[model samples]
Target: MRKTLCDTLGIEHPIVGFTPSEHVAAAISRAGGLGVLGCVRFNDPDELDGVLDWMDANTDGKPYGVDVVMPAKVPTEGAAVDLEQLIPPEHREFVRRTLDELGVPELPEGEQKQDGVLGWLHSVARSHVDVALRHPVRLIANALGSPPVDVIERAHGHGLLVAALAGKAEHAVRHVDKGVDIVVAQGHEAGGHTGEIATMVLVPEIVDAVGDRVPVLAAGGIGSGRQVAAALALGASGAWMGSYWLTTTEYQQIPGNAATQQALLAAGSSDTVRTRIYTGKPARLLKTRWTDAWSAPGAPEPLPMPLQNVLVSEAHQRITRSADPTVVSMPVGQVVGRMNKVRPVADVMADLLAELDETIVKLSDLR
Candidate 1:
């Protein structure tokens, strides 16, 4: 459906897809929606640059954005090696023992491991911002709270719109006050990091609070076209979708992702739990044995943000390399129950639009 958000971003649809794959991003843009590439995986500027280059070449002159986890709070200074030393021995032992008990094997040989630097750090995220600004990115979204004033000003100076995800009504107000062009009110049913409020309650609250100043995008448990229509009804100018793209064909085609896709397919809505086991932030993850182990008696408390992230970085590498679905930690939303099969991005969008039209017709008929 066409909305002010589409006109503001110069896109044909008011759908904004947040994904980590450049392929998925490009495909969404090519399908008339804006694709926001999640840059948390790219700790290296050069690697991020390469992905941006690919997106630029493949987007066919459509608009796209970049998302970075530039949290409002983080350690001011510390090397990865120094941060690694801060993780307690018991926490490390638990991760090691849990994987062992799950029978998850290690990598075969010569597979590259994820660097433990943890891109959520302020410095690394800023570096990503630097790289993104050099490209033709139309928008820059922050995964955490309102971006710093300077970052907002910087993006504005470059003639790019800035957006941020807020889980609370007050957070949306704060984001707009800080000059964010868009505020994504992501509820608890969302994938990854989330808040306590559900989408149904949070979206309208945020819209009522700041809809006059800026557009609000509805996120959390939004997968179907009906949900998109519902978001528009709640006063959101668009739907900011993340989890919907996880099972897309382009995502399943990524190397070392077969297990992830299978796990997501096998999971139901109740199969997920909100825990800080992965990123030290309360993110919704598939309730696997690895996550359950963290909740058992005598388990060490999870370290905050960067610390917990560093502690499990290596263990996550081993688990992924092993390709064991039982121990894999996949972040997804309750709407995951709707993600039953793999489809192409274009097909997903088309189905969503069809559903949206049908929903609107049904609502209109109710009168």
Candidate 2:
């Protein structure tokens, strides 16, 4: 696991754990992998700045990174109020009807609904970049695609490596061309927003296209040490894992997450479905009644990038508040099948390395 990426990022293993939990991210770094915090959950730059401060104190001086949601092509940008106007009434009604059908309860009286994630907007994402640059972050990753050229340049100026998620070889090439320091070749089986290529094929294709120019990190459906070995065999410098971390004990510490964790523990590899109902982009999510309802007859087509998320943001809150595991909305990969137990992040990291070593010895004996 001691690849160039490890040396570049100053970590023991080449694994990069992406998580929204600051605790999980810090734990991964302390355990020797670079933990990249997902910044999209923070709608306010000050909130992100405070979290980074906590990360700085908790990571034990280990290098960690931040992942932002800056799309290659900017989406409609505006204040939350202005963006709310763009959502069609039909979509709002659909969300309301679905929540009613699912028996999801609303917030208590006088408890206002939390605003939609403004981080999906370009302005908010850029603010994330600005806040991240001020921290001691070693890497900055864009979740959607290649970030704007100026953003890439700014990260470089701060002496930070820039990485972008690519679902295609062409997208990988484009990232390298735009001066991206790393490319995360995330496959169709990945959580959150993703494309149609599977990891087994996408990794090598991306490596062949840009491996010589920049290190490619293989993502999607990677959860164990054996899978990490496979990623290395496919020429990836490291493995970028997201979904597997969701069941970590540290992640379970997040308030109101028990139901979502329970759902992940109960899932199998075949229990996932790729749908555009999440973030208005094709994202792999746990198969739940909510996702199924979006596919039913008379369900309107999902709107594009930010709008769909805004329209359904309140509905997601209601679902989470409802505490129904069968109806919770979560972006997770097929790896959820293997995420049966809630263990410490350190324990999971140890198992991954142990499995990788065992796999290496088995393969060497065959020679």
Alpha-carbon RMSD, each predicted model: 1.3, 0.9
Residue pairs with clashing backbones, model 1:
none
Q: What's the alpha carbon RMSD for model 1? A: 1.3
Q: What is candidate 1's TM-score against the reference? A: 0.97
Q: Which stretches of candidate 2 lie over 4 Å from their true place?
A: none
Expressed as tens digits, the lDDT of each residue in 159-235 for candidate 2 is 99999999999999999999999999998888878889999999999999985788999999899999999998988
Which 10-residue window in model 1 sums to the lowest lDDT?
70-79
Model 1 residue 223 distance off true place after TM-score fit, in angstroms: 0.7
Q: Model 2: clashing residue pairs?
A: none
Supply every candidate's count of residue pairs whose N, Cα or C atoms clash at under 3 angstroms: 0, 0
lDDT of 1 at 323: 85
Clashes of 1: 0
Best by TM-score: 2
Q: lDDT for model 1, please.
A: 0.88
Candidate 1 residue-wise lDDT, 195-298, digit = tens: 99999999999999995889889999899999999999988889999988989998975787788888888888898899988788899998888889899998
Candidate 2 lDDT at 205 equals: 98
